[model samples]
Target: MATAYRQTHDHPKEYFVETDTDTEDSDFDDFVCSDSGKSLDATIFADLEQLFQSQGSEKNDQPGKLLCEVQTEENIAEIFAEIRKEYKPTEAEWRVSNIDERKDHEAASLLDDAFESVSSEVEKSGSIEGCSSCAESVNVLDVSQFKKGQHISMPGKFGTIYQHHAIVCDVKSTSGTKAELELIHFENKDKSIRIRKGIKTYDLKNKQIYLKHYKKQRYDCQLIVSRAETILEDFKMSKFKKYNFLLLNCEHFATWCVNGEEECFQVQGALQMMVDTLTSALGIGSRVVKVVQQLVIMSTDEIAKTISSAIVPEIVLGATAGVYLLYCLAKTAYLKMAYKKNNLCLTCLKITLKEMWLGFLVFSSTSVVQLLIYTFAVPAIGSGVGIPLVVLSVLLSVALKMSVNTFLRVLRNPFGKEKTKLSRPSQLSIADIVAFSYYRLEHVAIVTDILDVNERAQTARVRCIHYGLPKLLAKRQIVEEEFEMNLVNSSWHKFDVDDTTSYACEKRLSRARERVGEKRWSKTNRSDNFCHWAVVPIARWDNYAFEEVNDKEKKNKSVEPFFNKYPGYIAEELRLGDVVDYKETGVLVRKQSKVDQGKNVVEIDLIITSFWKGERKTYTIDLKRDDIHVMYYKPALCISMQDRVERALYWEGRRNRLLWTTNGFIESCILKEEYLDN
Candidate 1:
């Protein structure tokens, strides 16, 4: 047991590791987004980088490729537009897939003729239209360029191979007008997430920096700074979390602060671009490469199969695994080609199935190797004793696992027709797994936030384990999804997941929110339906970590703040009539956030009619949240209002001025467009 202790933990420095050899791209000059308030989506840059890399075959020509070779940003935009035009489901596709109102999931497919046409044209182009010469004077990014709470990326650890991120927090002291600045960042060495001083600040200032800004704001700057401060406080209180490269690294910290989502892309661009370069250089698969198998897995699989066959030729275990894997690979490829249209749910299922099959293949062969090596060679227990002991132990382990699973099933679900009674929820815990059913399947997700503490207000935020298979895969597929709780209904049956990581709930929730927003907004044009829901992702998480926070603590630091409802202009652009949707089809939720004193107090009232499987219910669903950061994107024009009230109270007997009741019977006053304009 001691010898088998493989310290699988990543070296903290691996977070900064990059390719050894420098490419022309090693000097990929960082560009500052003019919009400082815009949400910095690193993934978009990755895609853009991919487009540029596609142009150049050699590494020498790949650096600054997009800016020089691809010509203007217009070419990149044109390509993206082509992708959208070709991929977004048509009316016939959407309706044929589900008239019951399932979210439109785009089918992943082979390079369509539209994409092929666009790619061919791009490759054939002989000109660089808006290409700037290499001798052009570049804008030098310095300390003075960054605004308060602005996200800044420093090029290092190999030029643009990866970037170190930080938030330009504030001035350390007044010191007249020329004050020293403080940057909040995650330091792997100190194992602290906080504001750095003199030497650390000096080191940061010396690095080549660039601003990550977008034209439209994803979140308020004040909100961004406040979350950064909160995370810092948690560190001070002895909740020490080490720097995990794959998990909570520096890139993850800075992005989470700027926007309420935790994403480094798990990426910044250069690292992924390097891998893509290798694939291209090696002449790996082509357009069809984007099919079922992961490229990395596919590249080395034949080698892995060869090794397995050589290792255990007589047992035939390796041969069995190889054949099964080939079958799964073939099946997935066939499914990908077969379901390239209306039945997108089946498409998602195919991907899920591929993962399962691949996992089984790996697990079966690995288990055989591990069992034999550990028993015979390791610890050197005699073959006579080890073989019988290992076999009996395996049988017992299998039986025990089966028994425990059956026991948990009994506790969660009684032996009767499906219905669960309220036993006072044991305790409110963060990142608890929420379990429910998706038709016949048992679906699960990590509970990211506790919406309403009240028993009757049974709604919670969840980050699913790909539980949203039936729904179209959005950027954030079914992540941070809020649904009504009723253990009986087919549309709703849910409870805490049995295995809740006592820690790491904050990371899960943040990632889910970010991904969900990413997926939904990936399209160039956000539709009217996007505005219908107001359930905002709150920035609050368990600090005491659900350890019975008292009433006094609850008041100052609200576990969940009920709605601070007031009738006023929600946004200047949104008219009163437009928000008060009468149809049970969906209910608009709203949120108000402000920093009172130093604490973030968010008021959220989500009377969202949870989009069910066309299930009609008498009661509309309700959910609540705290310290909300998500703000609705103000629409350019207000949606037209129709007086849908079955019965309306005429305001002074004028049809232009009247009152109506929505799905929740919430009375709202509406006036004509003429009056509204005035």
Candidate 2:
């Protein structure tokens, strides 16, 4: 059996070796020198002796002090040369076994050099308080002292990386007086990094490592140190990247409870006291000011840490978390600006859906690979054994995964009755999917509806054939691959003109003319219902005439007729209450048109209206296009027939009507002569 040997000091400059064999002529004789008949060990005894003695339980015994006192520049050169001599023509087994040791030595040397440089610079700058209860202008860091590198990995659990550079910068007391500042340059570009200053003062008389940290105005360094030490009581190794216990705020409910209105009052008083203390120390007018200042400083370092910590997390979460936060902020800002100008929430769900689908495709594949590795390779390597546990492991893993998914789903929608949840890469809501479907279907419907009626119209045909169908088809084709084909088919063509009872009657009996491929239009034409006579009524008598004239070019031109007046109508200056037949309708003139159009004079007619008085109603005012009141032109006022038609159709559909039509005509009832004066 291989036996563990105690670290022992032998020849100070020579290597130390230990053997478990009772007799000298054992297999370990290979380590023995053939000529001297003595074992040639590979390690130095003096170096180990000094290290073990310095770290021993004794007053005034520190690793750095002992190392510095024993190992000088000459000593380091000799030790390194000796190590190289022993390792030369390196044995394969020794090389493999001592890789970590060699790395540690190399890293220590580099760190020592770096600290020496730092010490030289500090000596030139100012003197620092030493551990001897003496103020000395000495280089704090000696090259031969430190035997380890600051660059280290945080042990246990998460594969987090950390590097710490601390060599006791300054000591502080209960009084807010700090001796020196220790700064570590963390590689981070994020502006939100937080910085926290630690105290490094040692009590030489007490031989204790004194800690100093602030709490409000009065620095409660002792309290912080005591609490931290208490938490890490059992941890012997108090070093960076070591697995040591730490105190955490486990009272989440307490915070929430104090934030309430009733408890907030009590908290406010306590906060006031804390604030007052900080205000005095920071020399700020209010508690808020002091807090903000401290927070700003703290955040400098914290943000850097956060940036560093997030570097690996970004790999797992992808750029989505960061990008999403920025996107939301930007969108919110834009929405606010646009809201001030009266804009709508026009975020296209179609674009969002497309991106989600693509993202899902990539994420799903990655998740499968991750699942396989975690389930198979990870366990095998970590356990250092292989067995026929694949079937049982897979089932257990899948079941646990499925349970987790179910829990998440239940959390999201508590009221839902669904069970046996399976996780999807793209967590799209039913609402989102429906909205996307509706948007696509509406566009398709518009194209199909147009093709149903006005397929021959060049603009309509071109729009459906060239632009509309191509865009709709592209979306359709992509979506079909994503979703089921039956769902798309049914959603796009919701209304059935087939055996559907009432709608079937509405459908044309005779075969509709099929203009496009498989796309047909209604052969049965409905009543024109144009109301041309009512819309642009012909005037029985010409009352007023005017024309737009260019000031730059003076030319004689015939002015247009007012109130749909016929050219053959004898031009006459009409007065109030004059009866005039215009096309199919009779108009009672209450007032004449405005008698001004550039250089040419025009007349106005006031038609009769219900607003007119009994006897005086006979005289109506009819306004011409030139005599119309000029006001601000709003783009919103330009509502097309399509919008009105849609609203009418919506209302009609709510009433369950097969078909509904609107007469596009606006009646401006006014007596002909009513516009004379008033």
Report, for all candidates in order, the number of backbone clashes. 6, 53
| lDDT tens digits, residue span 1-678, model 2 | 001111110112222235444353223412332223344232322333333354344432232221332213443443344334433424553343333345435433533442343333433432211111110121111112111111111111222121122222222232111122332211123542222224333211111111111011111223223223322332222211132122111111111111110011123335434533332222212222322333343448766454433333224334433443454456456444432221211121222233333333333343344335434554455422322233344344334433543443333311111121212212221111111134343221111122122212211211111011225344211011122222212322211111321212112211111111221111111011111111122222212211222234221111111222222111232323233433212233333334333212234332222212111122222222112221111111112223322332233213221111111111112211111112
In order, the Cα lDDT scores of the candidates are: 0.35, 0.25
Clashes of 2: 53
Cα-based TM-score, every candidate:
0.22, 0.14
lDDT of 1 by residue, 213-271 (tens): 53223345665666576556444432224566666666677666654334565353344
lDDT for model 1, on a 0 to 1 scale? 0.35
TM-score of 2: 0.14
Show where candidate 1 strays beyond 4 Å.
1-143, 157-160, 172-179, 189-206, 236-240, 266-271, 274-678
- What value of lDDT does candidate 2 attain over all alpha carbons? 0.25
Each prediction's RMSD to truth: 29.8, 38.0
Q: lDDT (0-100) at residue 210 of candidate 2? A: 15
